[model samples]
Target: MMNDVVLKVEGITKTFPGVKALDDVSFDIRSGEVHALVGENGAGKSTLMKVLAGLHTPDGGEINYQGASTHVAGPLDARRKGILLIHQELSLSPELSVAENIYLGAWPTNRFGVLKKRELRRNATRALEALGCGFGPDARVGTLSVAMQQMVEIARAEAFKANVVIFDEPTASLTDTEKDQLFHTIRGLKARGVGIVYISHKMNEIFDITDRITVLRDGQVQGTVETANTDLNQVTRMMIGRTLDTYFIRAKAEFGAEVLRVEELSRSGLFRNVGFSVREGEVLGLYGLVGAGRSEVVETVFGVRKADSGKIYWKGGEIALPRPRQSIDMGMALVPESRKEQGLVLMMGGRENTSLPHLGLFSSVSLMNRPKELAVFEKYRSVLSIKTTGPDQAVSQLSGGNQQKFVLAKWLCADPKLIILDEPTRGIDVGSKSAIHELIADLAEQGLAVIVISSEMPEVLGVSHRVLAMSEGAIVAEFEGDAMTEENLIDAVSHHRGNVAA
Candidate 1:
């Protein structure tokens, strides 16, 4: 008996100007199987998916759906043929009720052509119930959390009986418990013989959930293997075609006397009673799973958010900072996770973004000092290696790695004693990641206190002198000396829980 092939791409190729995004890629999805598509950033995974979903028509080749030559003219055409794509950023009407949002385009109508609210609610309730969701049908989508909104999107897909579904980084914003719930839903879809296309940068999730894996690199297929046969190392090697530099350069430096300390930091719903200290030339890494409150802890310490109760000491004296500006004034800097959104103004040029954080320092008699500013830009442009057409080129035009360097340059200009990095290497390439790691170590060696919060375990283990593991909203474990291996760090993050805050 021949197995049913739900979807097939025959030598599909797509190209953007100056970038061959996809090169003669051929892939097939069988019914009732989870097919994982894995690759590093800029590996053309998103481009291939977009082509498959009809967001972009391939430059060459054809797609066969359900054993028939078909073209998905648009998203609506794909939806009509039982295809659903769930993006990382959910698409839903927030102000509408869950029931209304689920059946938005095809609401139940009465004999007089008026919307039948009762039937709409009943049908929506059934869809959520089938997916094991706990949300009420009448609940407003805007009021629900991101996890719940994702569930609603799944319910909407199920409501239409999607035969083929694509999940693009579905668990990026979800907690462990929420991820478990999503897994249950995926299993339910599998039981009903639906085909799933999973795309992600994470290895563990792909191995755990997918039946087969396809690795893409440089806009081409690297390899495809059975999930059981391929190990993480083999798959990672295929994804980047590389022997990765997992061992970071630990510039062992003699730490000076204590420079920063937090005593019983408390921020309700984020973290509470969180306390740690960093000496000059010390690198303290905060490691945890998504929603582990690692970023929140550092954000509070950097004064991005007001701590409900806590005492911060700089050089062993109480130093209270109520806002980020206050913290900046007292020699603290933060390179936020979303560099484009939070750290740099993408619409502006690189030199402007670099000078933004410390513009007041370059001002003379309420007028800007162009010469001094240009000199400062030249200094950082050389130091960070920010690739640009020129210093006057918009930051948005640069690559992901170069854009991240611009963010670092902006903060370094502030001349802070303590620097905090949240997901510092996120979405950046390997070469740039290495550069950033080296830069952080060099900064710490120069007698600056450094705090790094990263989701990547190897980075945390390789670079940090001390590691703190957080779960829920508090630190659950601490590792020092030689106890910071990848396995131990994963165990600590996976099994951590803390006392409930009063």
Candidate 2:
């Protein structure tokens, strides 16, 4: 690792109208180092990254770059100085081609201001190849999967050849294989003396990729420790200011009667011959890598997607789910993977989102009972420990963890019999992850049939009584208890074939 400090923030403080996002934050990143920034949601990690990226102007601070102190004027200026920020929420234009998105504002042009399309395509292809992407430059971004889109964003950073790259939850959308690819890319960057600031809630990634770890809590710096000198527990304690319990814990469950059973489900190009069953008081973990068709199977089960041919049985009777509403009316709730996209409306307030699906509960002849809605929102707000200024705070403004809690609140209000949680804890912090896990256990104890689809191996094994591994759009292996392990699950998903037995 290099000793030269590439970027330094001294006594930095940033404040919003009602919040001091960062306070006297002193941090430095050295060339050829992967420095980690870890904290709970709303703990000021994003705010600090924003200041560094020139997205937010610090109220007070000194920013030093390359042994010279200077103010970052804006995002463009920061990038020109070899600083780049890959935001957690994608900011790409879905309609644009991958090449156009890569060179978006920095389009190659002559002094006459004419666009250079050929150069853009060529460079984008080279960058995409460098990032190990299979897609070509002309491919429409909207047509790409979430993992591919994330790779495009990384490719943009690589093309920029930035000196100090700030990665905000870069691997949140990637699968284990994709994450390994990104780690490889990161190591390459580090070897080139490019400083990286990695922000993620997943401690395994932090320990595996970073050289130094910095913990931020309550808008201030807790401490920065050498990676070799610390462990997950210590870093987490610094983040939440408490001794956190185990990451995932599920109580021994006595499963009730079968709630959902799908037999020989097929969806042509997406998934085929998928079969599974979920029983009351049991968590059936659907484990797979990205594109392994876990979400597709659940989507079909919820009537979100039509299956080519399949038999679905609900409570021992074969049933046809023609629409989502039919499944909902039968006490089924699906917590989609993209919470912002499908779980909840971002522009709506928390209270409205929580009660939006069941407004009929508080409506009488086209008249909504306002106080009844308020009470319902309050009950879940307290129960889920959702952090918000008030019920009126827009869901778009809330952190990922809190927004996910609201999604949970929305479905919990429905009091469904069977819950399909897709990536329940994706893109959330450790503390919030623990809370959601506890809530899952509580739901199972209360006898709600839970089907959890997750790409995280530890989570699938920890939360479920049994797991069904999917590969190449089909059920490959079944794991439970003693057989439920990362190694075995990996082997099952990668090696097993033609075994749709449940």
Candidate 3:
């Protein structure tokens, strides 16, 4: 697929002091293409891949390459012109090894000089067995596993011989068999012609590993087509330029009885023999894949880890929480999936990080009461309608879907009954993920109890009613209502296994 364009990118643009983040951005990238880019979350596709990997400079146009005209000033001048990138956070150096982080700082020294450790462990085990990358070049990249530190950052961008690589969202924390082993190392870097570029949000992995498709919405260029003549509803209507709505109604729920329950919950090696039962109008979901422990079974049902054995029943007696301030004095509310590292505060103020973990119920004898925390942040920022420019702003200048609706108005103003959430719409935007799935179906029609934990199988079959799934760390399959489709819930979250009988 190389009609020889190699790379163009004219009219580039970029800007920041008030956000323009690329406009007039023309495109090209051909030589051995894989392309794919797409967009939506602050759509500048990581600021035009950080201005084509020079880490931002383009305040205007031009960037040809191989056909001439270039100036990638940073990442070691685009790694001496071969161009690398690969981020979605995985750069390695987790206390080195894996052949000293694959010949880090160009090792091989000797000739009466020193540091050559047997030819740097035989050329880092022949560049990780020529990219089959099974690890063990003296191991320990912090005992590897965020998919083996993203295959040692793709064997250090195939030992820096990258012919314009890029990647970015690299299977957003892999695991559909490690995303088919990263599509066999991106089809061996497109049979060695290399020009990749990938960035994703997983439209079935950009229609199963792109060939050509470009999208990018606000901040320009929105069309490139050709991934086998496109589809995934036209690359999601050219990445959210419209025709959106992927169904998620769920509103009429209204139950109330059993607010919570669990029996054999054990958290030994993280999630085991877990039991369930939540009512007050349920949702539940859970499902798995990225380390199939589903955030250690809801942080051990909200006591934030530490269980080793179980019991938990809330409405019908028992309650024994070992921490998280007795699971927030037992109203229990989590929502964590690193929303700005475990949910907000970016130097504070979207109403003081939404009343910072219920500031001890707005303390009085020990101070804190600024007009009752600004009238409890204007009443949950007008009950999670939070667009904010005022509750004193700065929740890091908002938007990643209003910083996840100010972390869902800080656990719905900590008036929890049992929420949990984790991955509650990661990296937000389809109109703030349909307004946080209609505020979790209006907080389960005002009864609360939620749970959630997702990996987006159509948002756990549209805000789940009863999904479950998980794998390896236990609980295998459950689904409900016309068997939650998306190919049977992504094959019950990538191949189910044991304990599921609920």
- lDDT of candidates 1 onward, in order: 0.83, 0.89, 0.77
lDDT tens per residue, model 2, 1-502: 5799999999999887667889999999999999999999888999999898899999998999999999999988887788988887776899999999987889899899998999999999998887778899999999998778877877777778789988999888776777887788888879989999999988888999999999998899999999999998888889887776777879567889999999999998889888889999998999887778899999999999999999999999999855798898889999999999999889989999998878778799999998888898899999999988888889998889999999999989989999999999998899999999999999998999999998788898999999998887988889888999999998887775445443
Candidate 1 residue-wise lDDT at 447: 88
Query: Model 2 segments beyond 4 Å from truth?
Result: 93-100, 116-161, 497-502
Clashes of each: 0, 0, 1
Model 3 pairs in collision: 338-342
For candidate 1, list the clashing residue pairs, or say none: none
Worst 10 residues of 2 by lDDT: 493-502
Model 3 misplaced stretches (Cα beyond 4 Å): 1-5, 8-13, 20-45, 50-59, 65-168, 173-180, 183-187, 198-261, 264-312, 315-330, 336-405, 412-502
TM-score of structure candidate 2: 0.92
Give RMSD to native, each candidate: 3.9, 2.6, 21.1
List the candidate numbers ranked by lDDT, top first: 2, 1, 3
Positional deviation of 111 in candidate 2, in angstroms? 3.7
Best by lDDT: 2
Estimated TM-score for each candidate:
0.83, 0.92, 0.34
Worst 10 residues of 1 by lDDT: 493-502
